[model samples]
Target: MARNKYDVDEVLEDKFDVNQLKRLLAYLIPYRKRFVSVGFMMLSASAFTMLIPQFFQKVMDVCIPNKDMKGIAFYSFLTLLAAFYSAFSLRYKIKYTNQIGQQIIHDMRYDIFEHLQELPFSYYDDRPHGKIQVRVVNYVNSISDLLSNGILNTITDLCNLVFIIVFMLILNVRLTLVCLCGLPILAIVIVVIKKKQRTAWQVQSNKQSNLNAYIAESINGIRVTQSFVREDVNSGIFNNLSGSYRKSWMRAVMFNFTMGPSIDIISIITTAAIYVLGVSWMINGETGITVGVLVAFTAYIGRFWAPINTLAGFYNSLLTAISYLERIFETIDEPVVVKDREDAVEMPPIHGDVAFDHVTFSYEPGVPILKDVSFHANQGQSFAVVGPTGAGKTTLVNLLSRFYNVDSGRILIDGIDIAGVTIRSLRKQMGVMMQDSFIFSGTIMDNIRYGNFSATDEEVIRAAKTVCAHDFIMEMENGYQTQVNERGSRLSAGQRQLISFARALLADPKILILDEATSSIDTETEIILQKGLNELLKGRTSFIIAHRLSTIKNSSCIMYVDKGTILEKGTHDELMAQKGEYYKLYMSQYASLM
Candidate 1:
């Protein structure tokens, strides 16, 4: 599979449908009441802001000229009231907007996470861990600013512009026309800058995502890098990534920085023209042209151009935001392809009988991983699968877990077709111990309890003792309260495997699977694990996949797999006596073990 790049630059140049954003906004439909309240508060704030200039006009023209104390007091009080209303309206809008933003993030994050969980194993196989991490954290965070401040500010700015334009026209239509003359040129400049800014911003975003992915991959592989002494080489690569990110960021900044000054120059030229025209009208003794009106008109001109400038800037931000919104929506909109069918029934308690009838599967079309595979294990039977690497041993266990459905054929448990059963119930009866045992950052006791969250302390201890993990766990600095660190980094690989074994044992599953479960352990630990395994597999149907033949030499049936086909099946002794593929593989490993 090809690697995916989070390069924002490339993503930004690609066209995105506006319909996706419309659909994303539909998630806020249930919060319309809050939206309405926020809108009202924003409008109220704008109205009060527009009223402030009118009051200044009154104080200058009417109150000062009349020297009327009562009128001055009343207008001053009205100004104070308007200020309070503006402050209150701002407070309400800010509070509500934050709530709306957080709610949207909460919903979007959950939707993305749940969708990820529902995606098939094949989907994960094709996707990198770093890319998924970027989607969950960085991509989700970017949208919060868009939903909260960006949306609210865009709406408020539009309303303010409309009100200011109408009020200015009402004051003097001729002067309003002069002030508005620069708008068309301003609008054209804004459109050009916005397009360039969007492209640049996209590039920057992509670079940042790539850098993040690189960092995540490097950190996770620190042990390998150290062992190979590739620190200098890795640093050089990191420097290259950082350099590319910085260059992209500089390009975006250049475009954004040009916008404010270009708009300001236009505003300056228009203001000069307005001054010349307004002074000429005054000299000609145009009726109703007061000094106060001229001053207020200039103030309105300032207000007009400021928003025009802000609108230009906002246009660029909106494009960046839209890009982010598209990425976030893409993840949430991914289809849940592994959902249960409407007619699928909840599975009953299992009897440990598992059968695969002529099963066939492939991760990709026309490339079979398991072909015409048939197997049966009666209740309490121990079945072992031995194979060369890439012989579909682990794939068989994945099929039994229904992580991937068969391309052709069916699996049955307790005489019921697994396809007809709900996945949740079907998986509930199985316990798995994989080669790379995952231990979360928590106490040993807490990790064991993860297998069955409802298990009591006594049950947890019993399970630990069954896996011979209790003694080592108790010797830890804080016993059951000891922190494991991320991925159990503080523990040896063998110790981590023991904890995972205890966890699986605690679950008390009817069927058990061990995939190279003791491959990392020393001889002494493997012997202890083997004894515990004997006890654990006594009454449960078990499927063990092992590269080490000694581990499964006593199983009820041993199957040798080669190139996605079952080459032989019989008791271990019988396979040795046959002197075929199994015999050759066992003899090769037996000679090496000596």
Candidate 2:
């Protein structure tokens, strides 16, 4: 319920969903045989435990009375064997349960990650990355024990409870009924606290997620926080989120602790009632009662309540796990908004004739990003799109690559609608270089080869040479094999861009779209990159967006876009001659240099 600068907690479910547990259990269905074996092992252990109390009762009633040493030794040996077998059963039970549990965790995490890969940019756009990560990691781990051991243990405990009840009835019907008196009272405690406990845990989960989001956000922006001296402010916010999580955890556990003691109180009161009544009845010369029966029945009382307490603890865990299950399943259920449509075929080899026909689109309804935008670019032609910030230049390129579906109208490549083909096939022949210039952690060679997996080391180096990245890379001791971390943190901005450029070109795409790709590079590198582009653009369709005049002056066509519309379009010389918006932007840059 708390909000901070970095994140807001997700909404809590108003009611417990039975289907979530059913679905969680469905994951175990594949290994039901293993779990079934666990159940039998657990039952056998309980049986052994039940028989121990019987041995004690026999010694007290018959063996001791007769002073029979052989009988005592026989029962003593049987008890040892029973304890040994019970321990053995439990050890194997734990082993199989853990193996099965880990596998289920692996499956759940894998499913969530695979689903995440298919999810669209919009899905990530709406939620914090840290929140999504918690569901995949922390939330899944929280329920691992429950899925692997808790359900089967609960079932086995219930069976143990039933067996104890049957043996109690066989001993004395009246005392059995007295024990039953505690059931309605214990059920009342559970019914009262179940909803409150579940709601508390749900809030706890949300708070933890919020705290994780802020922590992740802070770590990613720690440099900015330090540079701006916002560490104290950020730490204060973290403390508040951490405090909220602590409070919610305390509240949830308060309810969880309530269940165990309530069962204990009921058990103690019921046992005392049996003892008082049994003593008074024997004094009154009851024919059906005996000392051995009383001792055995009391031992059974201990056995009876043991499982009840275990069941109560299991119930508390179930409530806590249900909260996590809600989020994990919610993510898995997210729609893949940008996935390939049914009946989609592979796109034919591209010759790079791209067209947009009245391609109006919006990220949100009623607020268009690109309004009735239409254009045609023939194969081997380069177009320069100049636009002010938020003028839909980036969105235009995103739509061209089918990162999102257009709201209305169609975008065509080689006279075929892109939506008619599989997304993988459509994007395979096109290269996209965005402003970020992300570089993964690896040898420089591996990072360049990422977009084009089949490119040999020689080809990778060739692409690097074209983008003028080869010089700096070769200067390093390892040349192309030099290690670089994520985002190329060890490299300069210009070097990172050059490496990214090489990566894009290595794909040998027929249609290349570069959105502010050269913005990070220095003038010297940009000039060299321009020379490479002249040769590369000879047979490929290219859309280049940049603010520098040198980057776009030689383009076959220049488009000046503002407020989601193209204000002017022509060759650089023609737009300059027209003295339009493009002329004003160019003059301003020229004046700034002066």
Q: Which numbered prediction scores highest in TM-score against the true structure?
A: 2
- What lDDT does candidate 1 reach at residue 233? 96
In angstroms, the error of model 1 at 509 is 1.1
TM-score of each: 0.94, 0.96
Q: Rate the local accuracy (lDDT) of all candidates.
A: 0.82, 0.88
- Looking at model 2, the pairs that clash are none
Tens digit per residue, CA lDDT, model 1, 175-255: 888888887887787677777787777777677777887888899899999999999999998898899989988998898
Clashing pairs in 1: 7-206, 8-202, 8-206, 9-202, 9-203
Candidate 2 local distance difference test against the native: 0.88
- Judge candidate 2 at residue 151 and give its lDDT: 86
Clashes of each: 5, 0
Distance (Å) between predicted and true CA of 11, model 1?
6.8
Off by over 4 Å in 2: 1-7, 12-16
Error of 1 at 372 (Å): 1.9
